[model samples]
Target: MKNITIIGGGLVGSLLAVLLARRGHKVDVYERRDDPRKAKPWEGRSINLVVSHRGWAALRLAGLEETVRKITVPVYARMTHDPEGRTNQLAYSIDHKANWSVSRGELNNRLLDEAERVPGVTLHFGHRCEDVDLDKATCTFSRKGAEPATSTGEVVLGCDGAFSAVRLKMQFGRFNYSQEYIEHDYKEISFPAGPDGTSLMDPNCLHIWPRRYYMLMGLANGNGSFTGTLFMPHKAVPEAPDAGFDVIRTEEQADRFLRTHFPDAYALIPNMTEQYMRHPQANLVVVRCSPWVHGATAALLGDAAHAIVPFYGEGMNAGFEDCHVLCKQLDKHGDNNWGAVLETYNAERVANGHAIADLSMRNFIEMRDLVADPRFLLRKKIEGHLQAKHPDRWMPLYSQVKFTDIPYVDALREGRRHDRIMEQVLAMPGIAEKWESEEVERKALELLDKA
Candidate 1:
């Protein structure tokens, strides 16, 4: 059996521990934070995860499907609000069932609990990875009441998130690592249940209030509450850098900002100021790296490898899929050919990660602006009509990407192709010509086959 060490106890790392342990490999998980399950009232932190096919499939493979189902609420569609307060439900699927809203803390603790219960998995909490020596296949950690310690394994997986110590040490010649900070800032707030209160919004849908430069989003929780995030461009700030309105440094300022920008939401949240002052604002960025694996000693997964903007809600889903892909490759190799498997996995996933990163960025406009645009909707209506009339010749790219298990890279390529075809279709002599063009029909069929 191979000795495996996984850093980061977040969703991806915890799931990896459970998966590898189930394969009968000895797995040790080193987490930087305290055991979240021991905390009361879910105190430490809260972040919501949008669980779609990719994430759910990973949970099932890790044997935590039933546990997650008990705590998660399904989101059937998107409840989008316009600047003028008009609301519309866009079904994620034809029958409306789409994704699940899950608490990040709850899911992490559940995965950690299940992994610790596995015979071959050891859970080490409050053990922060300080350094890694890939040449020596050793990782050092810092923990309380103990001398700095080192552990060696046949392989070390860095799921340690965007700022990874493992990736830091593995940087040698020709190792390209770059991070692009998009012009966006985000803050999160939680709205608790009132007396005999259910969720303030529809619990079965992803709620979005898109206000041009800024957008508000909410996801349901098991405790009759919703966690919402406000995403806006940092350039939305006024000219004065010290102008208190632009800065979110204090409780009073946070309240004022929320009141002025998101008036309707201000009253829905209880202790909104406290939550804002307590929890730090998270920055949105796209992190890209090349060749995620270094020989057989180490590999990077999850956000450690690709940290994408949250617009498409594919961050966690993509990470979960990473675990799924890695485990599949490991099984195929029978754990003996680690070198070959690691290289192949890295090569296959980097392209997909880049594709999702780009798509997620583009979806921001669809969410914040196009959600309310009449022209965009009219185009969608026309596209849908054509799709229905010629099912074999036309299909909306959104349906293919969101509802199916098509590889992400392929989805992105097909989306670009469809966009090009749409431009030509729109320039046709008329709607009749648009539908009757045999060349267009043939290209559309080819794209569907690719999708």
Candidate 2:
């Protein structure tokens, strides 16, 4: 049996441990944080994550889909709001295979618990990997009180996050890497149970309050509450907006902001200030690199390799897919061709990672500004018309990309193709003129089949 070490027992790493161990590999997972089964980061801190088709398939492969279904709430659509508080509901699915809304910690704990049940999987908590000696296939870790421990393994997987120590060491040893940070900054907030002991927003929809340069989103929790996050430019407030019917500060300020900006939402978030002040605001970062694998001894996956903005709600989904792809490749290649298998895994996932990264960046604008604009709505209407008129030939970009199992790179390519077709059609004098005279529809149809 292959002995493997997985660094950083976050969601991805722990899941990887279970998957590898299930295949009869001896897997040791090293985690820096305390065990999630014991306790998690903070109370009432819900990390809003979307579990799409990719994530669902990943869980199903791990044989935990039923458990996930029991714990998750489905978000069937996006409830959008304008600055003036006018609301519009956009259905993500016509058939209602909605994305799952789950708390990050809850999901992590579930995965960890399942991983512990795997006979060959051993988890070491509060033991942080200090460095890896790739040449010797050895990993050294710093434990809480004990002397540093060392483990020798056939391979090491780095599923640590964006600021991965593994990636840092690889950089020091001369691996080409590049990263880009988008201009946007987001501060998260929460809206827990209120006076009536019921949810304020629709539990069945992912609610959004898009205010041009900023947006507020909320997802349902099992506790008859909603967890909300506010995505805005760092410039939204030099300090904090004033408190009143117009502006707000402190917990009182958060209450005021919610009541004013999202009156339909204010009732749901009781003690908004407490949720705001207590919850941590995380920064988003994107990463890319060459040679994610070093021989048969080391490789990187998940945020350690490609951390993208979460606008597309594919951060965890994409990471889960990474594990899926790796496992499939490993199954195909087997242990005899380990080197080739690892390299093929890197090559196969890198482009898809880049595709999702770009899509996530584009989605930020779609969420914060384009979703609120009249022209954007008009475009969507036209796109919807095309979908209805030519069901086989045309699908809305959103439907084609997010709701399907289409590869990320393929989805991105199709989205761009449709955009070009739309550009040509919109530049024409009239819709009928463009629809009747243009060859764009025929071309787009051909591309759709290819997509």
Candidate 3:
């Protein structure tokens, strides 16, 4: 068995620890923060995450599928609320498959608990990674109010998130990395349960208020409460007045904004203005880096390797898939053959990382602007009908990503092809009125055949 050092101890790191330890590797997970089980790790920022097919595959591989399921609320559809509070429900999958939502902090704590139970796993909390000796597979860590220390292992895995110190260390060598902070920023808003402990919105669906230039989303917690997030541009442009977080600086401004744009949400969330003002506004960043492995001595996983926008709801799932993929590579090449395993892992996942990043960005446009559009909704109906009629030949992009174990790169390519086919299908004469007819289906199939 190999000695492994995993940095971050967050979701990906914890899962990696469990996977490696179960294989009889001596795994050490060094985290920079206090253990969430001991404290309110996510005191002000409560980000909810959805785990889809890929995430479940990894959790099941680690023997934690049923354990994680207990804490999640199943979301089977997207409930889009209009400006006037009228709503439409769109099933996420043709077969009614669902994604599971869990609080980020809660999921991490559960994984940490599972990691701790693994025999060869050791978790070091409050230990911040400072620098890395990539060639030697060693890392230097410093904790607050404590002396700095160094640790070494046969292999080092950097699951340290987007702003990773290990990645910084690798930057000194030959490495390519890019980070783009999107124009959007997000703030969390808590939606409490009813007085009698019932969900205020449909608990089985993801609630969204799409306002064209910005949007608000809510995911249910198992405890009957919902975690809401408002995504908007950080600063308003001259062309788009009152379209950014800068426009909602004051309590009255926030109150007026919510009342005007998301009145239904405003009504559901008591003290909305107070919660909006109190929560911190966080930025969304898309990070892409190359050569995920460093000569077999070290490697990057999860957000450290690729960080995409959260619109696709695949951020955590993608990270979990990283752990699963790495473990599979180890199994294929044997744990002692670090060189071959790391090389194969990097070769396979790098393209997928880039592809999912693109897909996530594309989905952001669909979520923020297109979901409420009449034509877009019609297109969805047509696609769903086509898939229902021709299940062997057609699969919606969302289902390909969220409901199947299709490689993300292939799923993304297929999604683009579907987009092209749908463009033609939607442009057919009288398609708006005849979308449900056999003629439309036949035309779509013909176009698919041609493409």
> TM-score winner among the candidates?
3
Model 2: per-residue Cα lDDT over 1-451, one tens digit each: 6888898888799888888888888999989888877874675445878888888888888888998888888889888966566678877744565888988888888899999999999989988889888756688889887899988888888998888877777887768888876544555677656567777667888889887655788888877677778765443454433422123346666655667776665545555556655655555678978678887778888899889998899888888888888888888999546687788898898888888888888888888777777667656766766676687767666775567778889888878877876765556566543554336456446555654
RMSD of each: 3.7, 3.8, 1.0
TM-scores for the candidates = 0.88, 0.89, 0.99
TM-score of 3: 0.99
Q: Write down the lDDT of every candidate, Cα atoms only.
A: 0.78, 0.77, 0.92
Name the weakest run of 10 consecutive residues (lDDT summed) in model 1.
237-246
Candidate 3 minimal-lDDT segment of 10 residues: 35-44
Candidate 3 Cα deviation (angstroms), residue 192: 0.5
By TM-score, the candidates rank as: 3, 2, 1
Rank by lDDT (best first) = 3, 1, 2
Q: Please report the TM-score between candidate 2 and the true structure.
A: 0.89
**Candidate 2 wrongly placed segments (more than 4 Å):** 194-198, 236-259, 388-391, 427-451
